[model samples]
Target: MSDLWLFSFMDDELREKIKIQSEQTKAVVYSKRTCLRHNFLIATSKSYTENSILAYVDNTEMRSAVKDIQVYHMGTDILVKWQINEVPCKSDTFRVQLLDYKYQQFAETQAKDTSTVLFNNTSPEGIYHVRISWDVYSTVRNLYTHAVGLENVNHGVPAVPHVTDLGNARARVRWTTNPHCTPDLIHVHFREPSSIGLLKVIPGTDETTVITGMKQCIQYAIQLGFSYTTGKEYLSDPAYMTFLSDGTFHNAPKLSFDQNGSLLVQWLLRPGCIVNQTVVTVETNDQPAKEYNVTGDQPLARLNDLEPCAFHTVYVTIQYKNGNVERTNSSEIHSFTKEIGLTKIKTYIVDDVLLAHWESTQNCQALGYRVDLMNPTTGQTKAYLTGEMKYRVSIGECVKSCQLLVSAISVDTMVPVTTLIDVRPERVPAQPRPPFVRRDGPALFVWWTEPNLDLTIQSYKLFVNDSKKMIRDFEVKQPRRSILLNNIEENVVYSLNLRAINESGESQPSLSVQYKWNG
Candidate 1:
């Protein structure tokens, strides 16, 4: 009755035994008419005869090939789905293989369901081949699908852009392209330092582009984007860079004279600029111009061993490594004449005040004169500026001689003609008014009205007497009309005295004042 029974003609006993075994094992066999024409049979029992015909049925006859396989792209991922007209069993598993255009397997996955998702992380911008297979009865049968193109997938944002060959007014920008999708056009966006919120666009087919007409020493932000013909676009993050201009010597050197009468020259170095060398020329009216070479890194230069009384002109020139040369724009010709000591310097004292007079040489026009007097005994010095040739100064008491410095400044050259003199005054100044004293806690504040005089009062002296009859003296310098004595005894009455001193001698002591500390 069954296909297994058809083999009974070779052995009747075997047939009966198989019938009894089939009944006991609860097994049912399909006849030739019931099985599909392409089916193959497989033996399930091991005890069957070796010569017994065991038909092996291929699993393809029971399993159905996957049909209508479709692939769709969602963002950066690829979704695959298929249908099975007939399933051999509910527990059957399906294997899906993704291949590139070159027929090389790119991705393979197994799923128990009908649909799965794949990523395009490694695949390029082209069509892909999809093969899906299922196992039935230990045999695998696959289904081939049409090519799935990823041309319309969104590539998201591109890579950050980079700047190269940055110059004063030009720069080059480049970016990376997406391997999964090709763009119809690429656009570069940039913003200048002064033009925030305003973007400039450059369209090109290549990944690299050059931008021009940029400002020097300014920072710029650049970004790139890819656009498709279907109006989809993706923008990348911004990249920042600064542009540096060529070096130019635009600042002039400043000139001054130090205390030793040496000429000092200083200049500033501009940003993003380099200097190769500098040439300094000194020209005097009676001598030929002298040149000095200096390195670019050195910003200061000193000129020494020059005549003190001659007028000199200074010129500076700068040369860059790029074969560019520039001169000081502000007329590098500057006049520098050293100070010539004063002529016919004389000094005399009258009424404790010292009078000094001098005359400048006839060769130069004078702008003014400055006289400085120093008391060697007190190590104190004073200076006075006047347009006239005469100056009156004050010397303190018990001072026998003072050092004087008289300088006549030239109006055109600004050089001082200086002289040193020593003199002693014979007169003394009048006494000053008594000081008004006040006590605040343990401190004593003394105030006085300065004496009206034609000459300068160099200093003042304040004498204090405590309750114990101990005396202390303090000297007050010029420009200060008051003095405060701290650490005085509280609730004690203290006596104070004030006197004025000048270049000639000290004045008579003023009337005394007393104050009591209340705290």
Candidate 2:
């Protein structure tokens, strides 16, 4: 067995043991080797082998001489309250002292027949120390101390609140806090006559709030209270108000979209009641709602820059007398924006046909795609609509060089994505099959096979030149691949070459053919 002695027990446990009602058993173990004591409190019904407890032993003194000590700052006074664990001797009065954070006493008091004391006009942040006996010789050390800060003190109760009746089973409440107390919560206690009351709690920062779900045309008793950060509570006197709930909205809001896609909303208010302000809330899919506040006289609000291809919900809230809010009867107005735009577009050519393709966007309600081809040469534009993702146009002479504008067409919108493509053969007509030449005394006949009848080729050209320089040239149109030259010199070795020509400039000269003309 360990050498142990139970020197003292906590106040509550000691009281329970004295009354023979202690449902817990406490065991104290003293380690004579280490000069430390370990204490444990276990359920009286449970065996010591069934409970687990790890206790650290220290050589410190026993529990403080006082229990249930609380420190508070109310208004300009610092208040300390405590309970003694044992009855004091008549000569051993209570001593209360106010100390700084460093535990240096600044104010001290001796009182008999009192368990609490107040220090008037003291500084804000400090600690309070209380112990038995006023003389230093009678006390060994301070028994209990508590830290208090003036920042969270409760000064006084909140002023009586003002209540207003709003139609549709609602009432607005407004209140003001005392000068020095900053509460953490505001409680609005309201009760209908002869019925159980309900309490609504709101944040301390709110001076105005609304309570709903009450019976109309009934009188209610309303009161306000505050709860501070220091766990202190204060309540105000009750005030009476009758809920009339007679006001109502007369007209529903009208909604429309302008040409620029801005939402135009118009609403009306009750005729006789004076209004404070109007608030319009616009909510869109997957986005935070936006609010617009306007004067009471203005009934219209235009919301701009909304998401395209999304649904929007609009509503109006009216603020009237004594911060009361009333919502319109036909509140919700639903509308949709235009479809989204098209994605990246790509253009390619295959065998005299121009093909334009693009990606279809998600969440877009497009009926079809519109492909518009504009001829840069003739300045003519042709529009074609197709439901497929790709569109093909035959590369003709008129549209060899054109700009294509592709747009996704929906019920209400058509936004275009444009790209330029040159269908005209960029490589000069494949060097025409070696030109054939025959000379007849100062004249020559040249002919060659047409190169695949390319649409990019407008015509052909033949060059006749002497060994020194080019002498003459002849032009030939399509379908007449041969040209006759009459102005060639006789007995001269001439170099003859041919080339193809179109809107995209000229092709490289074909292989030169030598023909000596001797007449």
In order, the Cα lDDT scores of the candidates are 0.62, 0.63
**Over 4 Å off in model 1, which ranges?**
1-140, 143-160, 165-170, 176-187, 191-207, 212-218, 225-237, 242-492, 501-519
Tens digits of per-residue lDDT, candidate 2, 1-519, equal 222222222221221111113433554343332212333433233333343343333343454445676555555655566666552322246777766655577777776766666666674553334333332123233344454432435445577788877866787888876543455677888877658565656665568888887664345788887765445566677777645446343556788878665778998755545678888877787689988888647788887766656767777888765445666644444444334644677665544556677865433477778888777888888889899889988656453466777877778878664444444544446566668988655567788987477877778888777876757778898868887778777677888788787654566677888888766
Single out the weakest 10-residue window by summed lDDT for candidate 2.
Answer: 11-20
Q: What's the count of clashing pairs in each model shown?
A: 20, 0
For model 1, what is the error of residue 88's alpha carbon versus the real structure, in angstroms, after optimal superposition? 25
Task: Provide the global lDDT of candidate 2 against the true structure.
Answer: 0.63
Q: What value does the lDDT take at residue 91 in candidate 1?
A: 32
TM-score, every prediction: 0.35, 0.30
Winning candidate number (TM-score): 1
RMSD of each: 16.9, 23.4
